[model samples]
Target: MDQVALLQISSALLLNVGFIWLVGSWFARRWLGSSGVKRNDVEPALRKLDLVAAGVSAVASVVALYAATAVMGGISLQEAGPMFWMMLSTTHYGHIGCLTILAMMILFAIRVRGGTSGASDTASLLTIVAFAITRASMGHAGENGILSVSLAAEVVHFFSIGLWTGAVIVSAYFVLTPQRVATLALAVTDRYLNVMSRGVMLAVILIIGTGLYNAWHRIGTVEQLTRSSYGLTLLVKIALVACAIGLGGYNKFFGLPAAGRSARGVAVVRRVLQIESVLLLGALAAAAILTSQQPPTAI
Candidate 1:
C-alpha cells in the first residue's frame, strides 16, 4: 500500500482500537463493582488503559484530518493544511471530517479530566456518530442520489462496528490482558459475559442489515458480485465478518460457561478472544480495501 492507503488503514485500526478502549472501559465499570468486586479494587487495571482512550482519539484527529486531505483530495501532507482549509470550507466530506475531528478532540479533553459520567458517555456516543458521518460522506454512500437512506445505513453500520469492537475489547481486557488476578478475572468475566454477548448480538444484526442494504444498492445482482472487484472484495469482507460473529458466538455460548467451570476453560476463552480480536482486525482491513475498490456500476 502507498502512504495514503497505509494512513487510511491505520486510521481505521486506530479508530476501532480507541473506540474499544473508550467505551469498553466504560461498560466494564459496571462489572467492576458487581460480583462482590469493589470499584476501587479494579481501579488499577482500568487506570492503566485510561490514557489510551483519549490519547488515541487525539492521534485520530490529526490522522483523520490529514487523511481526508491526502486520500480524498490528492494533496500532499505538508501542503494539505491550506488545501484542507479550502476543502473544509468548500466541500461536503471535508466539513463532516472537521466536525468529526472536533468531536474527537472534545472527547479527548473530557477523558483528560478523568470524566466518566453518563454525560461523557453520551458525548462519546455523539462523537462516534459524527465519526460515522465522516465515514458516510467519503465512501460509496456519499455518491448516492437518494442519499438520505444510504447515509443513514452507513451510519448504522459504522455505529454497529464501533459497538462490536468495544464489546470484544471488554471481553478481551478481563480474560486476556496480562497481570494475573485469576480469581478476580474469572469473577468479572463471568459477571459481564451476558451484557457483552447481548450487545455484540445486537451490533451484529445492525451491521448485517445495513451492510446488505449497501451491498444490494452497489452491486445489484449475484453475477455482479462475482464479476466485479468491489463486490468480490465485499464478499470476502462479509465472510471475515461472519468469522468474527461466529467466534463471538463460540465464546459466549461455548467458552464463557466453560471458563466459569475450570481453569482449562479460562485458557480456552483467552485463546478464543485472541482469535476473535484478530478476526475483527481482518474484517476492518477488508472494509478499508472495499472503500477503494470500484463497483461494477462505476465501471
Candidate 2:
C-alpha cells in the first residue's frame, strides 16, 4: 500500500482501539458488578485499562484528523494541516468529527481520574458510534446507490467488530498480565468467558452478513474477483477472517470451558487469544488495502 493508504489504515486500526476500550471497560465493570469480588477490584482494573486506552484514543484522533486531510486532499501529510484546519472550521462532517474527538478527550480525562459514571460512559459510547457512522457515511458504504441500507450495514459491521475485538482486548489484559492470579477470581473469569461466547457469536453473524452484503454490491460479479486488485485483496481478507473465526470457535468451544481450571490452562487460553488478535489485525490491514483500491465495478 502507498503512504496515504498506510496512514488511513493505521488511523482506522488505532481508532478501533478507542472503541474497544469502551467495550472492554464497560464489560469488565458490568460483568463483575454482581460477583463476590469487591467492586474496588473491578473498578481499578477498568481504570488501568482506561489510562492506556485514553492515550491511544487521543493519539489516534490527532493522526486521523491529519490523515483524513491527506487522503481527501491528496497532499503529503505534513502539508495537510492547513486543509485540516479549514475543514474543521467549515465542513459539517469535519467539525462533527472534531467535536466528537474533543468530547472523547474530556471523557477520557474523567475516566482516568476515576470520575466516570454510566452517563459519561454512555456519552462516550455515543460519540464513538457517531465517529464510526461518519466514517461509514464518507466511505464505500455511501458511495453506491444503496446509501441508506449500506450505511446501516456499515454500522452493524463496525460495532460488531468493535464489540468482539473489545472483549478480546480485555481478556488479553487480564490473562497476559503477571497479576492474572489476582486480577480476577476464577469464578469471575468463567463468567466472562460465558458472556464472551454468546456476545462474540452474535457479532460474528452480524459481521459476516453485512460484509457479504457490502461485497456483493461492490464486487458486482464473479469475473471481477480474478480481474481486479480489490477483489483479490478481499478474498485474502476473507481467508484471514475465516482463520480468526476458526480460532475463536476453537477457544469458545474447546478452550473457554477449560479456562481457569488450572493456571496452565488459563495461560494456554491467553496465548490463543493473543494469536487470534494477531489474525484480526492482519484482516484489518487487508481490509484497509481493499478499501483504498477501487471496487471491481469501478475498476
The most accurate candidate by lDDT is 2
**Which digits, one per residue and each the tens of the lDDT, describe model 1 over residues 41-159?**
55556645656665686576567667767766776666676676776778876666666667667766655666546686677567656766765666778776325888789878877
lDDT of 1: 0.70
Ten residues in a row with the worst lDDT in model 1?
174-183
| lDDT of candidate 2 at residue 288, scale 0 to 100 | 62
Regions of candidate 2 where Cα sits further than 4 Å from its true position: 34-36, 143-147, 175-178, 182-184
lDDT of each: 0.70, 0.72
Clashing pairs in 1: none
TM-score for all predictions? 0.84, 0.86
Could you tell me the C-alpha RMSD of candidate 2 in Å? 2.8
Clash pairs for candidate 2: none
lDDT of 2 by residue, 240-295 (tens): 88998998988887887777586566677778878887877677778766656789
- TM-score of model 1 vs. true structure: 0.84
Task: Report how far off residue 129 is in candidate 2 (Å).
Answer: 2.6
